[model samples]
Target: MPPFVLRSPEVLLSVPTPADIDRIAVVCTDPAIAEWTTVPSPYTRADAETFVTGMVVDGWARETMFTWAVRAPGRPDGTVLGMMAIGLIPGGPGDAHAGEIGFWTAPDARGRGLTTAAGRLAADWALDPSGLALERLQWRGFEGNWASRRVAWKLGFRYEGLLRRHGVRNGTVCDDWIASLLPEDPREASEPWPQEAPTS
Candidate 1:
């Protein structure tokens, strides 16, 4: 399958290209990202190049995973604000309709809803009956990744519970929070989340 594109009023999502390697490398260098995500510690330019040129490319070619580079509408061909991916979940006995979703936002791009917007777009496309036909989208993250948990909740993913020692980060086992979104779930935020009042 050819590269897919998803766009919203504020953001654009597309397959990562060679030109995005520099931005990817820089973004992955942020300690927060490396700490919470699977990104390599001391992330290097070579890692970014391989991800864009190898993983991203081969994933689409094999139909096993789909990734998108997120950017602002004004800089469609410029720097990426973040990245999102949907991957097939291996299952037994005729079960091939499940997928997992993951994402990370550049440090400079956080708090602007860029990652949330990008995630919404990806989920919409993946769950469409005429698109991937995926029946469920699983979301899992380290237990303390509140930001990621908030995004999943905002996307209408129902909280399932927690898994003990089910996640690994930087080679150490850790607990994980799990959630899922079904085709019938609302695409908009449905639950009330507490937030600090804006100060004038």
Candidate 2:
């Protein structure tokens, strides 16, 4: 599938490019991103270059995963507020149209709905008959990642319970929370979000 853009009132999702390498590198260094995501622990400009100049472009070229660099309107071209991707979950005919969603937000961009807004646009396109037409889009985050879980919840992904030892973080296996969204599902929180445990 060709690279495309998804728009929202507060955010726009477009493919990240070589020009955004610096910003991408900076964003990936956020401790929280590495804690919950697969990004290299010590993210570097070189990694960013390979992502934007290599992986990201190749994902689109091969029609396997669609990743978008999220930014607000009028923001500088290099201002990447977040990253979102929906990758085809390889499976047999019964699961032919399944995909998985992943994302991370810049520290400064937290507490805003931009990530949520941007994600909705991505999911909408993935499930639309005229779009990817995927029957299901799953969300997985290592347990304790309430931030990512909230976004998934707000997007109406039905919580499907945890997958013990399913997620790997910085090399260690960890439990992962899983959820799924179907094309016909209402795009709203399906249940009350669990309150976060207070930090000492």
Candidate 3:
């Protein structure tokens, strides 16, 4: 229900166009994207190119994963805001129905409510039955990554628990926070989640 033509203000699962690569690449290279997330330590233009042109596109085409590129809303024209993604974690229906969310913002775009905004959008899209019959959507981040945790909390992902030494972060093992949103979730702080309850 968003106004952007290439991607919805609500979500952006579609593959980004070649025209969008440069702006997206700039955001990808931010040290923030490297420090907290699983992206290669020294992010590069080739990594960005592979992601936009290869990984994201191929994943969607193969029905193996989902990804999105966030864009700003209500400007004179659309402004590239950030990016987000949800991919089916390994498992069968009972397990695979649960997807995982990941995202980042342009350095200048942070602290402006952009990450939370994009989280709500991507959550809705990921839960859309026509898109993916997700029973739950998860957000996992290093225990100390307050920014990542905040985005998950703002979007209504309850803290399930923490896993000790659950993730390899910046070459060190770290605890992780596991949070989720069920298909039946009634409210997402910043945007509307699906109305229908999750099916078993």
Counted clashes in each candidate structure? 0, 0, 0
Model 2 regions lying over 4 Å from their true place:
74-78, 92-95
User: lDDT score, residue 186, model 1?
Assistant: 98
* Alpha-carbon local distance difference test for all models: 0.88, 0.89, 0.72
Q: What count of clashes does model 1 give?
A: 0
lDDT of 3 by residue, 1-200 (tens): 22122334543333465667677777777787888888876777777788778887787776666666666654323455777777888784586787899887778878887778777777876788866778888889887777788788788887788899999988999999898888777545444332433445
Model 2 clash number: 0
lDDT head-to-head 1 vs 3, winner: 1
- Runs in model 3 deviating more than 4 A are 1-14, 74-79, 92-95, 189-200
Residue pairs with clashing backbones, model 2: none
What's the C-alpha lDDT at position 86 in model 2? 86
Cα distance off (Å), candidate 3, residue 179: 0.4
In candidate 2, what are the lDDT values of residues 95-199, reduced to their tens digit?
Answer: 659998999999999898988998899999989999989999999999988889999999999999989999898999999999999999999997888878787
Model 1 regions more than 4 Å off: 92-94, 191-200
Worst 10 residues of 1 by lDDT: 191-200
> Clashing residue pairs, candidate 3?
none
TM-score (C-alpha) between model 1 and the true structure? 0.92
Estimate the TM-score of every prediction: 0.92, 0.95, 0.81
Candidate RMSDs in order: 3.5, 1.6, 7.8
